[model samples]
Target: MLATPSDFDVLIVGAGISGIGMAAHLEMMCPRRSYAIVERRDQIGGTWDLFRYPGIRSDSDMHTLGFVFEPWRHEKSIADGPSILEYLNRIADERGIRPHIRFGYKVVSADFRPDEARWHVTVELADGERKLLTANFIYLGAGYYDYDDPYDAGFDFSEFEGDVIHPQFWPKDYDYTGKKVVVVGSGATAVTIVPSMADKAAHVTMLQRTPTWMFSRPAKDAIANFLRKVLPEKVAYAITRFKNITMQDFSFKAARNKPEKVKQALHKRIEKALGKDYDKEAFTPPYNPWEQRLCLVPDNDLFEAMKSGRASVVTGNIAKFEKDGVRLTSGELLPADIIVTATGLKLAIAGKIKISVAGEPVDFSQRYYYKGCMFSNLPNLAVVFGYLNASWTLRADINSEFVCRVLNHMEATGTNLATPVLTAEAEAKIEDDDLFDFSSGYIQRGKHIMPKSAKDYPWRLNQEYVFDRKVLRQGDVDDGLLSFTRAGANAMMAEEQLEAAE
Candidate 1:
């Protein structure tokens, strides 16, 4: 236990988008609070920095993905990886957040000391040395996937002579020029990679077990660009963000309420993009529009590549990998010089950091998610899990603001502890709900590790951003559910207070 002169008010994990957003919020709303950020990677921009595959870009528009406090001045709303990194860097430098970030430091585990009302965080440095730090609160801004490993689809590449690669660990400057490339998935990564690689590769094939629904939109937002020319940057950004958020919510609701109609509209757009002669089976997914995230194609680039015979789509399971190429279950042989396994990600909760309360390990699966941020019975800790239906930053912004509110309330009340306590009776009364309603492979596989959700507010991670914004932003801090107490308070006293409130 290394002792320091003072503990940080908040210790943020992962200097990514969520961490940066939370830090910026603290600066504005709780300026008196001290904080620090620990990043596992050597650089900023968590997702954007990690991925270096061709045509790597945001699935959602930048208006909503960009932080609420900062304006995305780039021309392209569907920004590339470098552009997004630049935006994040500008925010970090401009807000003086870079100085507070400690790169190459990975959080191994965190233990909450109830008596001290602080978390003892153990971190492993890049050189494999361990150090300890204490903080009043811990904010996990680390993004949801396993950074060390990608999803393994169990493809037998033993006999395949081609260079196999996963997008998570793309080799630097590895040329695929004039080589036949087969991207083994039809998710956003495959869609982005096929067209990008087709320019240099001899031919590119997007191989998928099942088709994925895709929608085509321009890379640049005409309305957003026009507004920027006439109005103030912040005002224009706000309007654009509002418009996009509304459209996203409406689209999701429409897909859920009227799946057939939404499906037809999506197919109609794809039909217009790809000619009538195109293979419809390869483009049509069995699921509804929003069941899984709809891949976005910028300016019909994918369609153009397919039309030009540079790229193609193959919808089938791989029977085995042959020396020359992949052999499909349909007995079709596709020749390839390189294979990219864009088979999606493996989700890890709380950045896979071992969390415990008073020496007893906390099982998040047994606990309830409180207001889409903190887990029930967890003291002074909040994890940022972004919304599935909208831009990741939408939830990030709201969660950051909400956490700040809790911190400020605790300060005003002279309390150092805030915990969402769910009693046995209350827990039994709440019916369990799925953490996420999406049928995406990652979501389905990661359900067991996720925090439990319930049927009502303040007890579940709500997916509706509009509803969450109002409740998390404007709702009272002392809502009878969250117990605020001073440091060194006995457990019995907190329980008695909760009982009295109930």
Candidate 2:
């Protein structure tokens, strides 16, 4: 039997950007709705607080990464982890969202009761106590990657006499000064760490099996800064956000439609940054631009570090780990005093929380994603999985607003349950598509666990931010796909009829 009297109207998992955004939206749109945010960590910022490595910053510009309701007033568009954390904290305090967040509480599992039209959520408290809380709806914003485990590249670190560190778990006050540091992998983490560590390390070498496309832009946005000086803060922010979103969308579409042209443009920028005589193989990727996310180098910092003889890039397969350093397949020995495995992340679905409906476990791989937020046949639950090609908060903002619309619709219609029901006949007619079309290692590894997708909107997680913004914001909530029903409506009606006969 389920607990009586629901604890909250909505239970938001993870106090990350997505979770906070949802809460903020509820305050503005659904003022009377009671909601709570549960976060495993003891802090407010999710990724910003977790990652403490040097030069840890946002790959995307802050205008887009920031919440739509808040303005990013920092001079630098590419913000550091601390500054981003500060922004989130400010939003929480100003909006009174911090009071609603219960830190150090991890959601263990959630089971939806069809009869009650609510979810019985099980959470593990900080002191290892399991608590039960029931809510009318569940919103998961726990992020995509596993917080406890990172993607293991399966490297033999026995022979290495130096300290081995993964960026996910950076040691506090780690002294790499005057030490030869080697950072493995070629993604954003490696690019950011190499240049930042080069300032103190004797030398920093980035080792990668394959090269990744790199793009450089100034940390500060000149136009955005200029607009801020002349216009009001909110107006300026709105204009800047719109501009960045348009440019991002255009670039992604261009890369997809005209690969060769985009590739040439990217190569030209790299050639200009590193000089024409630089090693093309070290900077060139086999795939076209945006095939994987392009590493953003602020103010050509990585290139400057290379030019200063403090940092370098080496592309080769690792043969083994030597006593002093790593051995390459090409019979090259890169001596190092410290090794930083700047590897990728281990992706997880729904924060790895066990979900069930009517006593049956939910297999997300078999269920279809309904409009990128809710799942098919899953009632009163929504998960925020951000965009791959653009800023994460862009999707988060839309999804939060969409959820608000859903809640308001339910109240107006006097319905207790909202489920996106996909009939067997309709499911048979739809074709399956890759949930995430990207070739990133994490995406490929986590594909089997992800929800199924189709070729069209309302069935798949749409990549186009502009398109999603319009559809999610202006779209109808009572679309025939979503079936709404009141809990115990028939029994109540029958009782009323019997009373009338007497």
Candidate 3:
């Protein structure tokens, strides 16, 4: 892997969970390949660094959220935002992944030159200068949620007197102590904030358009703790990871197959916690479980808060923001000193980076993902979008390994460019599947701009991590559909051979 004019062999965008994991894998596997990561933010720990709202944490357990190569040594399975950030920071420090990260490098555009076998990327630097860098391949691990543009509920709060806030940019010094708080939206953020804010707030209300499915799990995983006490670190971690993944898969699959049974069981437990005052209709969603992600409440903190009368839940539409608080469509006035709009995230398709191949801009909506990593007909470009149903890191790990395998294959075959080539027949067989099968507000809002998927193997997203892990990890690298060609004189021989065969 001799160095060339193209700054490095590979350029990875974003230092988030996916990006960090990708960098780790590259360093471990393709040690000789010169790679650098460009992060728009000034710091690492992408999600854990960006979101700082009260009680902001992973809905997924730490066992799976933790990287496959690393074992989570923490006692709490349901970790807080700060703890997660610390974990990520520890990983970067221990693995020496920090030096390879170029913070404050916001990539605005990436143009691939097939003839030249290189990608010219333009990044907006902190000093307002546009820097053009080149790389042989580009891996977009920027993540899906757009922190810049959180989904605005379009509420006209000009008439209101309270402070409006969004969880994406929570102020560090802002105080809500003894203040009445009303959090809009029933997703994970709302549930988390309600319990956390209720500790000191005069009262907290979770206002929602519709109820989202919520499940309760213990904050501390007893089984994992016990196993670690007896078994070796690696051995205990492996067993715990497998158990959690299996349970997650089973829960999701069972929900899909028998949503009613799962719904009833969930409602029953919530009802028990909420007591007789629980409005079953208000808490019941029209959609089935897993249609949207199931919100998780560790140790029933939200329910405990509600039961203690410090917090409550209200399901209704907003008429307008009144002088004191939000006026429900039913004319119920929920007074609040502060309103946190935990509405949802705005999807950043391809990290909002302008990507082009041979001067033609890539319209991702028309392109289907190859094995949920590489885009169809896109050359030397791969995106590590993780599983919706499981830990995001799970898919990231698989995609990163697959990228390494592709790199190895290219080097073995002496190919400069690798592109997923689809025949007319293959394209015709493509099914119009959503890139992510989620019903969250943010996802539905950006549905039109999302990438497409197919019904065929590799092209069709299995959505399950187990299926992807098997295929992507064990499958052949020199697949027929993935076309590779040498840069200059060597490519002529490949064309000649193809022409002779026809």
Candidate 4:
């Protein structure tokens, strides 16, 4: 039996950093309006709380990753997972957003009904009971990466007599101490896990299918720390945030404008850190800088691990899983007591919730992203997704502010529906490399599921703070693609337009 529908002015999914940010903005914009933030987990911190692998941490600097309105009070720029999680929890508690979050409620599907001009949401409870809800607007703050098991279940793990573990679905009771372990994958997660686990494990081997460019920076920002000691936490946080943002803008510009120089500098850094004896071809990516995410090494822990003879790196394809270990394509048999598959995550956009309009499924693959927020033909729904190059929160903060502006505009104008009106022709011809060129598993799933543009101003992902501020923060809201309609008028909009034309 379906329970009575819970109504709200705004309903947000995923209670993560993005969702909470949106909720805070909504509260500030319309205090009298009803809003709810739904989360599947018992706790609030989305990725930070879910991932419990050995020495888990953020790959990006914390100065840029933390919320803009609320500064992160931590001394370190690159933070471990627990510290990051604690900071998020503290923000929720301090901001009074915790009370608004409905824990253990997973939204299964959401359908937009034109008749009511509202979204009908179906959510499943922790107790295996289903509930129905309706709202004027739906905000998808659910992140891109899947939080479930990290490994591909189809992999023939049974053939390996050794214990296998995926970082996403870590076992609490299992101990890696004094055991020879092989960690697979070459991205940030694998790079981090090997160095941290090497000290505890007897021997840690990092098996990379393709080498990624790794760079080292100190975990603690000396300037930021000095400022924290002299000034307030909030003030220091702001200073660090500005510094990080400016640095990112400069780096992105340099990479784009002076590609050769950026590549040369990157090559020099890798050579200096990895030593001249290291295979340069295996370590350097074939694409330009920021084509894929770069690996972050805090204070060169990965190199230190290698120097101490506790860790080693190998580049090869896995042929098959043997009873005792992995067999590489080079015909080398690496003995491993434990295998860690840090393979990438599954991409789940809008938390993979099914959406339908007038009983017809809304094919996300066919739709286009409007300014990387709302989708074409989908009214009153916005998603939060950041750039692959720059800090995620910086982009998300802009998105949050934009959402508030949109909501305020709707209220003041008496508009109930706003949707991007991209034509089939525009969507079909628009081509950008970021949309389809990615080889990552997550990108593969969402290939062509977003808007792609080279120019950063109107619809492109410039990843520059300056460009984003001018276009997203201060740009005109009444762009040509967005259409607004009042309540009870959506149904008659097409008919009225035809009559007026006649």
Q: Model 2: number of clashes?
A: 0
Q: State each model's CA lDDT, in order.
A: 0.91, 0.91, 0.87, 0.78
Off by over 4 Å in 1: 1-6, 489-491, 495-502
The lDDT ranking, best first, is 1, 2, 3, 4
Residue 410 shift from truth in candidate 1, angstroms: 0.7
TM-score, candidate 4, is 0.92
The numbered model that scores best in TM-score is 1
Summarize candidate 3's per-residue lDDT along 1-502 as a digit string, tens digits: 3245789899999888888888899889888899999999998888888988888888999999999998999999999988888888888889888999999999999998866889999999999999999999999988887869898778899988988999999999789999999999999889899999999999999999899899987999999999999999989999999999999999999999998999998998888778866888877898999998889999999999988999999999999998899999999999989999988888888899999977889898877778988977777999977787999999999999999999988888889788777655667756666666777778788878877787667775568899899988999877887778876757565444333322
Q: TM-score for all predictions?
A: 0.97, 0.97, 0.96, 0.92
Candidate 3: minimum summed lDDT over ten consecutive residues — where?
493-502
TM-score of 1: 0.97
Per-candidate clashes, comma-separated? 0, 0, 0, 0
lDDT of 1 by residue, 49-160 (tens): 9999999999999999999989999999999999999998998898889998999999999998876788989999999999999999999999999999999988788899
1-502 in candidate 4: lDDT tens per residue? 1244439888989887788888777766667668999899999878877888888998888888888887777777899998988888887788788888999999999988765768989999999999998987898888877666443635688788888888888888678899999998888889999999998899999998878767688998898888888998899888888888888778867876897888788778767777888677777676676667678989889888987899988889899999988999999988899999887787666787888876778777655566766766677898887777777777778887887787777888878777666555555556644553445555665564544543333444455566666667787676866767764655488324323322
Cα lDDT of model 1 overall? 0.91
Instruction: Report the lDDT of model 2 for residue 92.
Output: 94
The ten-residue window of minimal lDDT in model 1 covers: 493-502
What is the full ranking by TM-score, best candidate first?
1, 2, 3, 4
